[model samples]
Target: MSNDRSKPWFAPKRYGYGAGLPITWQGWALTVGYVLIFIGVINFSEQDKPGSNFMSVVGMSVFVVATIAYILICAAKTKGGWRWRWGGKP
Candidate 1:
């Protein structure tokens, strides 16, 4: 929404576009939660045999939606926003 860049929770990458590691506890929590949700979704979606090719469409859809939402939130919380960088100053 805005490029105010005030107290960002995530830092921008040094050499390329996108956010890097979390710079705040909130960011860390968000990342950890996402990972947990991802694992849960996969396990729940494939409740069949160990090597089954059956995946719940609903579970996969939820995962995809969550992933997109996470990306958008990360981009918004990243310092200097998301953009290309050549290892220069922010």
Candidate 2:
């Protein structure tokens, strides 16, 4: 093995256990938005009200859409795009 320090400490590894958190503002926003929506849904569901099923469906849809958007954003940042590869490059 060679002491290859060409890559910066923040640069992602081609193969490793896993990459850390999102490096972009959009990524962080999406993550925080998802969490807030999730919490809101849980609180709303716990209330005694009619049409809870409909609310649940809507919440689920929002969650799914957010998740897909987050995934796509991450993919766009990576070279392999949705595959297991290194990211955080210029």
TM values, all candidates: 0.83, 0.54
Residue 90's lDDT in candidate 1: 63
TM-score, model 1 to reference: 0.83
Candidate 2 at residue 3, lDDT? 46
What lDDT tens digits, residue by residue, belong to model 2 across residues 35-75? 88779877766663675587677777777887787655554
**Considering summed lDDT, which 10 consecutive residues are worst modelled in model 2?**
4-13
Cα lDDT, model 1, residue 76: 93
| Residue pair clashes in candidate 2 | none
Please give the distance, in angstroms, between residue 7's alpha carbon in candidate 2 and its true position after superposition. 16
Residue pair clashes in candidate 1:
none
Off by over 4 Å in 2: 1-19, 48-52, 85-90
lDDT score, candidate 2: 0.55
lDDT of 1 at 46: 67
Clashing residue pair totals per candidate (backbone < 3 A):
0, 0
